[model samples]
Target: MRTTKLIWTIVGAVTVVLLLAGVGIVAALRGGDDEPDPQAAPGPGAASALPAPPSATSPAPSPGADITGPLDLLVIGVDTRVSIPDWQPHADAIMVMHINEDLKSGYIYSLPRDLRVDVPAFDANGYGGGRRKLTEAMSSGAKVRGTDKADVAQGYELLAKTISDYTGVDGFDAGAILTFDGLSRLTDALGGVTLKIDQKVVSQHRRPDGTARKLRPGGGGYTGPQATYLPGTRTLTGWQAIDYARQRYTAGGDYTRQRHQRQLVRALLTKAMGAGLPADLTRAEAVLTALGDTLVVSGDRNAIEYAYALRDLDPSRLTLVGLPGDSVINNGRYIGEQLTPVGRGFLKAAAAGTPEAYLADHPKLINK
Candidate 1:
């Protein structure tokens, strides 16, 4: 009887252990499948520390074979006054980057910010609201629908939805909304990219006389702040490059400025991949670390795939095409306003994975 009792006790103990193990396994699976409960409220440091929240409306990741192929990314630069008090918050910068599966070739279609479109807003029912200025969706929504704060993430989502409505491109996700300051960190990470300012562009700095100090032209080796000022085909430091990209007060206004920004991007990509820089992994790590906090990205998988896809694109293959000159209305009110029809064509071309027609129609500005 004693032996039988002991046998039963051992069996009971084994069952308990197995039950606990099963419970743990079930918990792990549930955690993996479930999204974080939005009602759970983030901790004190969570707001600033966390990356932009994942798109609630984003589609599920594609299967392995479908992951590769042509991918379109809508990269939006949000100009929030609260974020940058010096500049007005506008959706002035828009680029649709198309990356092919082979990663050997890619194209960037830079859209004019003022191109009037039926700006889509996010309604309470999770649908889109009617049109307005492309830039106003975020600022206005933050004022009305949101808590009157600069919510860039929501703004991005609205833009993505609007683009989707205009262009029938399904699956093209809004990858990221990088602020202007983020450019500084990105350039720094690449160990300061080189850009040739092809014109005599003047940049004013703060002078001791309560005035601004101007930077004169010529090919000069520039890094950091000074690098940002040099114009017309010359090496520039990270900050300088960003400043060069941000300058819209040039003779051609925002249109010219957009061209310059695209040029700088091409130059930077060329420098980073060229044999000119030393193979210092430490510096690269530092640059990425500095940019880690400032840079905003969408899905991690998407970013990783894009990096791989763009690995083989040569500088020559990189076609930087601004919107057509005819599409722009240089009125006294808005210097670089984009016409809706032309803007629609540009977006459609971008969505269709071909922008050569648009580029062919637009004349390249002589690098000043």
Candidate 2:
């Protein structure tokens, strides 16, 4: 058990994250034209294209078709540091939000960043297929488009396409990419979030033996005296929340990190409802600007209407699950994660709007 309370960390800036965190930003601002630009690699048009919005009467397009009711928004959170010049980002956390037309029921799924995949060649990033982490798909796709020229929009398109292929789902209705900055600011703004940790966790990098050291814990940055999270519930600041979510050193590895993120998501949701952050446009905008400097967002009016319809949604209705997979160092080079049959079934079932049914038969992570 573990948790991180990152407000904006749940989704893109204020708009998308608010939607997933279960709030009222569905009435979008056209000014959001500033979203990142991503161009899909040639072919696999099925993977890169966004179809038109569906009518209220029509159900969302089947797995691969255009936007329809009961939409799935693939929100990919990239943990990149702007302080580093020309830092290529990887999709740190991949979350797909499935909401029904009524918005009464919703679900979230987190795809481990290190989940492995076979990436085809793209001229911009220059990769010719073999095996690569699922998180690498965006940057690889962006590279073919030109590092300087590549934008998050194109990155999202490629990543969405790849996820669709991996899960055998149709197209994703909307997609957005958030960053660690969002997580930090949201946590800070909310005055910290409370999450539960199942077991004592110490960084393999910093506190390998679950003992505190004169270090900054497992997370990469900062100068501090070791980061340690005792099992049970704890309230965390923005940066601390990010650090907690960054830990992937336990025997569970990435799975542990994924659970930490979900915990944060729930904490944020609880905070947002009580804190009224979304209703506070000024502070919310400032937080958005600080966290999501650049984001890729796509969707149609139909999706928006449903978002509006979900205004009074109860956070309890939200469901969280991880794709089924086993860690492996397949081939000599490929490493990290591989999908299991159960995971594929979950994805397929999720796309078909029946995740709870699958969960009824499977185990769920802590706080999910």
Sequence-dependent TM-score of model 1: 0.63
Query: What digit string (tens of lDDT, one per residue) describes model 1 on residues 268-290?
Result: 55655563222334443454455
lDDT of 2 at 158: 63
C-alpha TM-score for every candidate: 0.63, 0.70
lDDT of 2 by residue, 1-368 (tens): 11111122233333354553333352333235345323322335354456533333533332222223465666677756556666566788777767766555676778878887766555444656557788888776654334454455555556776777776557765566676656667677667878777777754333433233453479665453466778878887776677777787775778778767766775676677676654666655555565454433334333334344455555567676766678776476547877788877787777666777878887753144
Q: Which stretches of candidate 2 lie over 4 Å from their true place?
A: 1-15, 19-68, 120-130, 144-150, 203-224, 277-307, 331-334, 364-368
Candidate 2 worst ten-residue window by lDDT: 1-10
Best by TM-score: 2
